[model samples]
Target: MPTLASTNAVEIDGLGKRFGATVALENVSLAIPPGELFGFIGPDGAGKTTLFRILVTLILPDQGRATVLGRDVTTDVWDLRRRVGYMPGRFSLYPDLSVEENLRFFASVFGASVEEHYDLIAPIYEQLAPFKDRPAGALSGGMKQKLALCCALVHRPEILFLDEPTTGVDAVSRREFWELLDRLKASGLTIVVSTPYMDEANRCGRVALIQRGRILAIDTPTRIAESFGRPLFAVRAGKRYPLLLAVREYANAGTVFPFGDALHYTDRRDGLMPDAIASGLRDYLRGRGFADVEVKLTAPTIEDSFMARMGEPERAA
Candidate 1:
């Protein structure tokens, strides 16, 4: 089969999409290399779905251009459809159908059989094998996710687009789903995935931090976290809500936000030592009559970097 004509499996130039007065996507441009696992990191309404739909030919862009496998998305959508696999954010399979039946139906759509491409989906399918006779709607959230993935891969497409594949699933299922993607990547399938989870960003080979339908930063997770360019600290105490507000009111607080059980923060005082900052934070919380407090230097994470980028002004890429 003929594949992409260039090293890039997907390319977008100034892509824009709007629904009524709302801008679903704005001037989005990106290049996805062949056989690479690229992630579109963002929350809901960040235009991740809109961009994916355009690339998949499910919708048309109001402006700009995009190509899939080197074929124009607008004019060559049929060809693109045949070469790419897309697992939408929703589980759109026939819920009433049994697992094997659904898989066979999707395979037939692409004029292929599940057995013909079983190896491509074996890792994920194996997890759902026992439930092959169960109705899709009756399966667990994790199993439904796996079944959707198998249906998407049944035709052996060269590239895969997964939109928020982990949302609503349990933590263990989410991790397992990503592990499956990792295996797929190792097998030379180019994959594009979108997720709101910051930790999932680290699992991708490269990620594009997006917000409000714009690209914030595009690089490996390590580079994006390192670009924070601020001394970060984590503070925790009893009464987490009040602690968050109190930390934000600190005079030297550059950026403050609750992170898991601790508040991830940055100091505004440019050259202040970590010890001094921690001391000041501890004293401030203590002075407010709260005895329990722990403030210390903490490494910046992908969430911290994403929040930092969210606060910064958008610059031209």
Candidate 2:
């Protein structure tokens, strides 16, 4: 049984939800401490959106229970809605409305004015102020996101839930968005964000990796990468395709997947030293007619850990 703690900003126990034949979430449970910039990391269709909807009081769970800010999400939904801010995965603000209109409208919905909580959204709102007259639909992807975030913050809710907030945005915009999140976290706002990008996981204080409606792992980015617990190597060759196929055919290969420009390889046999493994892999690749093969022991990243966990057998629900 999972228990909720008063100290926790958000808590869930044995939470499960299904959509007809599709299982959206299954026995998910976790506790997020207050003021923490927590993230739910996973690829598309990994139950991230469903979980966020439940936390933000937009949907009811089929089983189990969840509490946000010590209030039951299922029973205290109306109260929770008033205290929490949610920015859905899609752009939900009115497209025909000007930026300022959208902000004022959302503020009024919460029975508050933009002036009352100006300080809460100043950092982000300042950027949008210049384009206040512009229709939200006419703004760039990044600007639209900023506008949505400002609206979400206008009421100064205790916690903010952002679902894939950076998806479809430019690379530079993604970086800028995370910086805004850092500043928000510094202001002692508890933020719960979900993203499909593995690199974004590093920005979170802690992250939960979800796949196929199940929680695979949860920990700091560094700790999760450390948990890979295997001798890994980055193998690169002039001929990428051939090298990948060759490495996959190796007898000791546990996992081989293309990672950026190199193929990250892990061995099935344990107890072999890193140096010995690297040398063996290099020799094997060289024997396969790849004279330009470069094999080196490499530190595992959060993506590596995610891939490893994803390859494991699914846990029984």
Candidate 3:
């Protein structure tokens, strides 16, 4: 595939787009290498969908340009469509059509046959075959997601764009879906997926945390977590809520945010000490009828790094 600089599968530089008065995407630039599993993670209204649309040629940018597989998105949309696969967040498969029918329809639309691409979608289609005769709308959330993915893969696209592929899926289904993605990545398919779940950040090779149409940070999940520049401690009292309030208001509070069952606290950047506050809060919480109370330093999570980076600029520390 030809890239703008000859080293990327898709390239976007100084890209800008808008929807009436609202800015959909602003100066967004990213390069995805060939056969890479890139992720574009963010919350609702984060311009993820907008950027995907622009890259896939569903919409054009007002400023800057984007090229996919070496073809300009604006001028070579027809060829780009043949080279890329997209699975929108919504289920766009034909509701009235059967599972096999939906798959065949999309395959024929691209002038390809399911038999020709069975190897490309075998991992996913195997699970979908049991319900091949069922109406598209009758499949469970997990089944529907798989069917959608199979439809997207039937064309053997060089670059796959999945927008929140696991949203609204059951826990088991979500895990299974990711497992399928891992196998697909192993097959040398370049993937770019977006999701709002912070825990899923680790699954991606690298992620771009976005909010309010701006990026907070872009780095490997481990690197992002390690970028936390403070000594973090997890504190839990028998009474958790009050304990959280107390720790958050403490004079030493640098960043106080809730973890799973415990609260994570860090000393202020200025002068507050973590050990002193931990010792003090340990006693303060126990005095309030807390049992088996625990306080100790802990590792930062993806959500922690996202919140911290969101509070700062796009540049990493």
lDDT per residue, candidate 1, 1-317, as tens digits? 33357668989889999999999989989898998899999999899999999999999999998888898888888888999999999889999999999999999999999889888888888888898999999999989999999998999998999999999999999998998998999999999999999999999989999998899999999999998888888888898988888888878788788788888888888887889888998998899877778998888988888888887665434
Per-residue lDDT, model 1, residue 285, is 88
TM-scores of the models, in the given order? 0.94, 0.96, 0.92
lDDT of 2: 0.93
Model 2 agreement with the true structure over 1-317: per-residue lDDT tens digits: 33344789998999999999999999999999999999999999999999999998888999998999988888788888999999999999999999999999999999999999999899998988889999999999999999999989999999999999999999999999999999999999999999999999999999999998999999999999999999889999887898899999998899999999999999999999988998898899888889877889899999999988987754432
lDDT digits (tens) for residues 1-317 of candidate 3: 44354578888888888889998888877777887777787888989898888888999999988888878999888988999999999999999999999999999999999999899898889888888999999999999999999999998898899989988887899889888888899998888899988888888888887776666677888988888877788887766777777777665567778789888877765455767767876776666666777889889988888788677754443
lDDT of 1: 0.90
Best-first order by TM-score: 2, 1, 3
RMSD of 2: 2.2
Clashing pairs in 1: none
Off by over 4 Å in 1: 1-4, 313-317
Q: How far in Å is the alpha carbon of 144 misplaced in model 2?
A: 0.7
Question: What is the Cα-based lDDT of residue 57 in candidate 1?
Answer: 95
